[model samples]
Target: MDLEGLLGPQHPVAAAALISPAGVTVASRGADLDADFEIGSISKAVTGLLYADALERGEIRRESTLGELLPLGDVPAARVTLASLTQHRSGLPGLPRSARPLRRAIALWRHGTNPYGDNLEQLLTQARKVRVGRPRTRYSNFGFELLGHALAGAAGRSYGRLLHERVIDPLGLDHFYLPKAVDQLGPNALIGRNRRGEPRQPWTGEAIGPAGGIRSSVRGVARLVAALLDGSAAGIAALDPVAPFGKGARIGAGWITIEAEGRQITWHNGGTGGFRSWAGLDRDAGTGAVILSATSVSVDPFGLSLLTEHTRTVLNS
Candidate 1:
């Protein structure tokens, strides 16, 4: 497959790359393997890595709950297992009930307002008041926000610092970082664009960093992906499929695996007000790709197609 031709000049993605399992850059555009892009919900995978490492170190057990790590009390969701949070079966809503998401959605559609601004303290307070629904597989950014803090508290550090020490630095991913403030989203950070060509606000608030605030270049992501395949990452075991979620889908610590085209593809995609991202690898085929679109267009198909195509390339190479 023509990976470069696939990422033509007209694609909404400002920066993208195809990386080999040997940590070599196979193809790229708009930016090299080093420029930063907001990784969106891919941050959840980082949190998943932390959770897994914590378990390996005996810092926390797989079944550890928020209440055990923090002062979250007996809130139903607080008692959810770390594994459940990683797998998104914590029964926690996608957002805090206090968020009034219906209104937030309207605001986002009309004014492009960021729905997430609550600081860590406010988020924790809201989590205490949240009424979790029945136990089932439900994707929840709020649940991950809480899980990030809970893991940090247990480790006597902050989420950003823990992630740096445990995942980023160890993997030699120097380009990956959490944007702590608007200023942190500097020139290197790709400006996400709405459909109308208007720049969207950078998602940089502290409360949601663990869920969606990470920024990295395709190269950094490629390095991380390579590490995941090589077992060089301390938390690579987090990629193990542990719980079933949807038809032909299974959940790992922070990764999701789906059966497609006769291969089990482990992947995760992220989106924000203006940007979209897809990162995945086909272990059996030994190929992976990173698709980062500056516009909020879904790129899951492109990413998967790229991986499927890569399988053919590996066979021929």
Candidate 2:
């Protein structure tokens, strides 16, 4: 499909896997998968799954208020719930405006200048000032970050530790972790470059790991998608057409739904610095694809179009 031409070889690494209800599977770029790309917002789906598991285990209630789980101190964050947080209807800004000088934000947190201890409080404060949208749809990273903090608080652990214990270990996804320090990142980690093709320094956000910081291999992501599509996981089930938000272009828990060329596709895309990734599962046909790139460009639309066209051809055959 000329993927290499479309996305430079140094910037593109694509993986696809087709799953069947009878447990049959086929994969490309599956065996040797890249494990160290910054997965961006796709981490939200994983975080959502963790929260779903917590709900199932009674560790936390989906309807539980944020204020009940953490110390919001006069902040209207109490009005937000786990569901709202995942759904991005928590009235939070996309991110803190003060976070412009990303390095300074990191320094402030490192020096313990802010006790909510990160930009999370700043996000919540912005949310309080804004109008909460209707419960169904809106995209906000601020809300997801709040959800991360709330989940960690409820579980009595740090966000990274909770993700490891509840999601990664259980799923046997050994290759993923939220980097505590930039130096801990692997040698193969993708470097972000600007549109001008200038290398950009590695940037870290304060305490917003849950919102968009998860790294994974192409095959590892496929396994997770397979589990979800087959309903093999305890708390996760395949996309239900009758769910609250319609099947396409909707957010359920953490997954984004899309209907492409007659296939019901549930997917998520993530990007950070010099890395971009797209992961999707076609529920009706029981197939999925994952694309991981070391560039900041939007590769999901192209990948999705290719996967959708290929799946259609096969189904017609």
Count of clashes, each model:
1, 2
Cα lDDT of model 1 by residue, 1-317, tens digit: 24457655444455555656555454456555455777899999878888888888889998788889877787776787777889888888998668787898787778777777768888888888998887798899988998888889889998888988898888888578887787776567777777676777777777898899898887788888888777788777778898897887988888999988888899999998888888998887667788877777777888888877776777678
lDDT of each: 0.80, 0.65
Please identify model 1 stretches exceeding 4 Å from their true place: 1-10, 26-33
Across residues 1-317, which tens digit of lDDT does each residue of candidate 2 receive?
35555455445344444444544343333124454566788888888877887787788886898878777655566777888777776655566455444665474334322212255466556544554545655677767877887888888998888987876777776367776456767654555553445454454444667877676666567677777877765446313322344433666777778777666788888866556778787777766666666556777876687568656755676
Candidate 2 structure lDDT:
0.65
Q: What residue pairs are clashing in model 1?
A: 33-219
Error of 2 at 305 (Å): 1.7
